[model samples]
Target: MSETGRLILLGAPLGNPADASARFREVLAAADVVAAEDTRRLTRLARDLDVSVPGRIVSYFEGNEERRTPELVDVLAAGYTVALVTDGGMPSVSDPGYRLVRAALDAGLPVTAAPGPSAVTTALALSGLPCDRFCFEGFLPRTPGGRRSRLSALAAEERTLVFFEAPHRITGALADLAAAFGADRPAALCRELTKTYEEVVRRPLGELAEWAAAGAPRGEITLVVAGASATPAQRPDDDALRAAVAEREAAGLSRRDAITEVAAGYGLRRREVYGLVHEG
Candidate 1:
């Protein structure tokens, strides 16, 4: 049990009330002050969970987060348990709650969390992409120019990338992604996660862009994109390719096998290697 005068960050289910954990219910019921991104939604959630919140319910969303942080920290400093809950997922994750958390930390107040469902991790797991290493980019800029600049800067990032996007902007975002990362870059679009109408679309960036342009789905969206290749982008010169093939052939390998080996080593197509060797 956390001591008094501590801040607890609560994680709400993405869309399903059934995803709420037992610990979350306990903490929600115990908090002295419940700062919610959406008070109405929080009320509905508490009703669904059959948990009684014997605490003050206050609005703590984006528009008022700045103004509310100091007040929440003051409450925490006064030996009260304050629980911060966003509309969904954990607070401060492309959502409200960061300011209040930072204020509490700076004031030497205790801060903890009741872990809940996360769209970021959920989408990454279902995307069928590498998850060993990844970077959460939150939401991209809404404007085309700004989004392009951000995407261009991240073009060479070797770790898998995750992002939150709006349904209305998904088409343009995917088009920009294709242009920056290349048409063939693999990606997944997860929609209405943990909800009845859940949908996951996996495709190349260009194809995704086309699909989105055709008709954008309505709901919260999470995107997972494959990383850029770690290998050097520059193709091997003809002489280099020829030399590698010849060296492999001298090591008791057949010409066909040598070409395949050399191509794999240089991250090139076997036909490129063959053409290089036969273009005498």
Candidate 2:
């Protein structure tokens, strides 16, 4: 409520115009400066909505997001309401507009968002996996080496994984995912969500990789992968440990070596095995 300008982040429709929210329209029409990820698409959206942009239009995208941020910030600080719209979904969700929003907040300007469609959440809803806890990975590195390294970092991650991938590169991405996450991990491949050609295919990570290799879809894709199950260490009970000690001792083995064998067999530390054996 400082009569100063407000930085309004608007969520554009991912693929379908009908997905446009009413708040998106109100913000776009009332804004004095509209920063769009793609001006051409913005124009198309206006046409589809039969709404005209009364405010000045400025292009905001990845290539110019950093440099153009200052200009937008200056405009926003001057008490001119600025609206931000990305090519798809919300701004700053693996897209531009985050820098400008940060700049505005730093300048003590008001900032808000009009919640709308998100491919990540939509795909997660359709994934049929455990959605209670999940992680959004966005897009992986373009290069194989970088992708592999990044995937390796998430290999031990227990939360369900969500990622956005292009249609053409999805197959390669799936292959890499399978390699890092394992073959039998359950996964769902969602393509062209909210669009005419929307498709969702759920299967094991390895089989999905093979399916993608054989043929990948041709649209935006969001992949949801199940998290790794907790495999608690299997420690032998007292009886099992004593029997193992008996077997190894009878086989001409020292108690120390027998403890090692039992420890390795039960995936327990040698010290743990020793302690277990000494207790009664």
Alpha-carbon TM-score of each model against the true structure: 0.82, 0.80
lDDT score, candidate 1, position 33: 92
Mind giving the per-residue lDDT tens digits that candidate 1 earns over 1-280?
Answer: 3345999999999999999999999999998999999999999999999999999999999899888899988888889999999989989999998888888999999999999999999999987667999999999999999999999999999888999999889989999999999876667899999999999887667778998988987899999997886783477678988998899789766686577546544556557778989994
Choose the strongest candidate by TM-score: 1
Off by over 4 Å in 2: 231-280
lDDT: worst 10-residue window of model 2 = 260-269
TM-score of 1: 0.82
| Full-model lDDT, candidate 2 | 0.83
lDDT of 2 at 132: 91
Backbone clashes for every candidate come to: 0, 0
What candidate 1 gets wrong by more than 4 Å, as runs, is: 1-4, 232-280
How would you encode candidate 2's per-residue C-alpha lDDT over 1-280 as one tens digit per residue?
A: 1358888999889899999999888888888989998999999999999888999999999999889999987887778888999988999999997788888889888899999999999999887666899999999999888999999999988778999888778888889888997775667899988889898887767778998888777878889987765663476578888888779889866676566556545545556767877885
TM-score of 2: 0.80
